[model samples]
Target: MDVISAVGAAIRTAFDMFWDVLWPLVLGFGLSGIVQALVSHKTMAKLLGDDSPRSLSLATLFGVASSSCSYAAVALARSIFRKGASFVSAMVFEIASTNLVIELGVILIVLLGWQFAASEFLGGIVMVILLALIFRVTLTPRLVSLAREHAERDAVGRMEGHATMDMSVQGGSFLSRLLSGRGFTSISHLFVMDWASVWVDVAGGFLIAGALAAWVPESFWQHLFLSGNPTLAKIEGPLVGPLVAIISFVCSVGNVPLAAVLWRGGISFGGVVSFIFADLIVLPVLDIYRRYYGGRVMLYIFATFYVTMAAAGYIVEIVFGALGIIPSNRAVGIITHGPSWNYTSILNIVALVVAAILLVRFLRTGGPAMLRMMSKPETSGEHDHQAIAMDRSIP
Candidate 1:
């Protein structure tokens, strides 16, 4: 194709990809908002306290049920961190939201392969544990103090997002809601929060993916990543793939396609997993960290995460290889269709529009006023274990 036609085609392709995820992003974000309402800062604070294994496990479980949006995950991480969660627990929440969600996992299997999905799942658990271990050893008292100072600063200067309406649950047994008895209004509140959290991440991811499709050459991907030299190939592949993914700024399941391309071009198994793990370190997420935490804390956390992800990837690759379960060879193309007009895309566009409207409204209303609009349930106790007030609007 001629240069002009090629560029034109690329633009259309980008648009098509964005179109495809637009609705899912919206629906996902709304659902995120809803879940946020159901989960109070008190509940989250209790479930993500310092030095408690129970807290960590609950945080992970909460994240899995939360939205699959990277932005939302970052937001939530920042919020919980500010609300007095230990750095490790906060990071666990971030990992679980990005990697352990149901929809994202299914999407990875559909677009990449079952193997990729499995790696992502197991790798995420390993990553959280590695991070916890790192923090336990390397995170000094100074670092903890520094994080707290930053968290306080962030709590004060935090920018407003769409705050979920406070959902009021009936004072009843758990079996009631689990069986057949949630109020309709409470359910709606849950839906709204869910949408708010996941959409922005999806939108940001799609925008980045589109830009890449429009400008980056497929061949360029092959050379930097793909290689057959075992030593140079092994570390280089994992390292470079994640580096590129970080700069590319896509995260969560949205990263699967680009990862698949890198793998197909001959990047190693470790490389693919590293790329997946690098989701939280992307530019936007880092920016969120800087905003929520201070520059020093952000730097420390970033360095820690980068090392932990790379190590986890290498370890998993070695273990899997030794076990003779390294998937024989790399999986091939799974993103069968390119950008096109479809029901999914149409839904995404509609969702985006709705999200935009809510964002505008939230901005105009301002954070405190918006929070006031969300009434709390009468006689609710203080958030568990928090030394400070926190915004639940975070991821």
Candidate 2:
């Protein structure tokens, strides 16, 4: 009976956290869908063909405008790489898509604070710059060749279909295309597809966070984070942050809830930031990298990513500490709150209505079939053409 009660409490906490962020998630995804519906992957590929400053900048911008699903981001990065994007640029895009997205920032603001959200974006840029330098120095022509050769093979990874599907509406002014039937269908399709790609991770993150918040003693977290010694904690937080995240098996925006738990449990601000950035290096994503780029390149990526993620955490911690903006109060309300008549509830209601509308559009316009193909690997541009044809047929 005690265990059952505990489980229920954990689930309730998870639901509360989900409820708190529901509106931000919906708004972020809606905006992302609109961007995806307008931007062509072909244009992104063309712009990112080289590793110049321009290409890398464009990659970051494009990544911020894309889906925040870690799996989809990884798959799409590979697709762009195979389609003529420079290796460094592709990696930057992957990092930006997962770490610097709008949904992620909004969720952080809601759960942790605006400081955390700011740290995430700032640290993301630092990580990207660090990674680009590292790659420029260490990425060899032979390694690139090996990765390309492996990627060219018919190996499968999660969200391959999503990465390849291009539903961008074309052949009109921006406003005209956006107001067209094809535009609505395109946005709905991309929105649903993005949700499908990351729902499991998101759910898992909330559950784990809730469980940790409910069952784990504050003493345990304090000891694990070395909270007794401020100096040591600062040094260790950034270093160990990514290691914890690598084992968490949670990625994308899903990790934000867990991050809030960690912060409340006495983790340093830098630790929370680094943990969020390390989503790309989670065990499952590491395996995907191994499958997509062979073991050698995978190992190389893991090494570079770890160093940069940790470094970025350390830098952000120092910079933010100097600015005196790190929120001293670590209390997150969602962990203890239940359903109530409040602003959160009001926003969640509105969000659900928006979600329902998009979902209805998705169901009415052949979204189920598209979802079935989300995991299937793409072999050519045939899928994009077919998707565009289907969009034209809508309405």
Candidate 3:
């Protein structure tokens, strides 16, 4: 291909990937916003106050209803930890928030397939359990104390207010509030905040997938993944999956598209799962974790997360093999011709309209000001943990 054609191909590939998953993103985040509006953060903190099975389970459930942005999850996890939630429970919440989120799963289904999405849910639970175990064994009181001190220092996570705000509509029944004006405002804030939190990751995933698909020779990925030997591929894929994510500059729901590209490139099924599970461990996120919880806690979080993610991947490989569902076809190709007239295109058009409506609602609700504060640490995080109004439902 000529230089112009090559560039055009890359751009088209990226757009195609974006168009394919655009509707799913809208649907997932919109629903997540609704969930958040119904749930209260104070309730979350109260229920997750201890590290018992009950607390951990509630934390996971709360996280599934909360924001799916990895940064926001980290920020929120810190918020609860500072509020007396156990360190292990908070860590479990962080994992569930990012991995078991609706948008992440929807995007996975759209891009890769149902099987990959299934693996995500299954592996996510396994990863969380392993993470909890690791933290219980290695996380000591002194380390927790140091981490608490660092959180009190308020080093300013990127989406502090986005994570900290409790905009759930007050008064009225569930349906009434969901249909109220304040409810719309809450949803808009959540929807916009969710987008702002992960736009970079999503766009980065698209661009990286495009570049990788257009430039990297299949032989390189195949040889690197040990695709010629099935057994070696299974072992190496899980091991290298997180390394790919660490360097990919993409995480959260954003990683799904690139995961698609990697799946097509010759990675094993378990390798794909491991890659998606590593979003929070990416370099930028690791820095964010360091800021939120201090270096010692960050190191433990990294070590535990990486080991659990890899183990989950291997377990998925064995389980899927037993179930006779491991896919042999890895020949899916990226779209380079722009969006064709199809159901996905129609859905994209409809989704764009929904997104536009939400954006308008957000701006009118002082979302721009909220965003300004959220983006800058000086403004939004001046006192990140300076206790919000103590209001919660003790479930």
TM-score of 3: 0.93
Return the lDDT, model 2, position 394. Answer: 58
By lDDT, the better pick of 1 and 3 is: 3
In candidate 3, residue 247 scores what lDDT?
91
Model 3 lDDT per residue over 322-369, tens place? 999987767554343456789988998999999999898777666766
Tens digit of lDDT per residue, candidate 2, span 8-70?
A: 988989998988898888988888899888888878889999999999999999898888988
Note the residue pairs that clash in candidate 2: none
Q: Would you estimate the TM-scores of all the predictions?
A: 0.73, 0.96, 0.93
Q: Which residue pairs come into collision in candidate 3? A: none
Task: State which candidate, 2 or 3, has the greater TM-score.
Answer: 2
User: Candidate 2 regions off by >4 Å?
Assistant: 385-395
Ranking under TM-score, best-scoring first?
Answer: 2, 3, 1
Error of 3 at 218 (Å): 0.8
Give the clash count for each candidate: 26, 0, 0
| Best-matching candidate per TM-score | 2
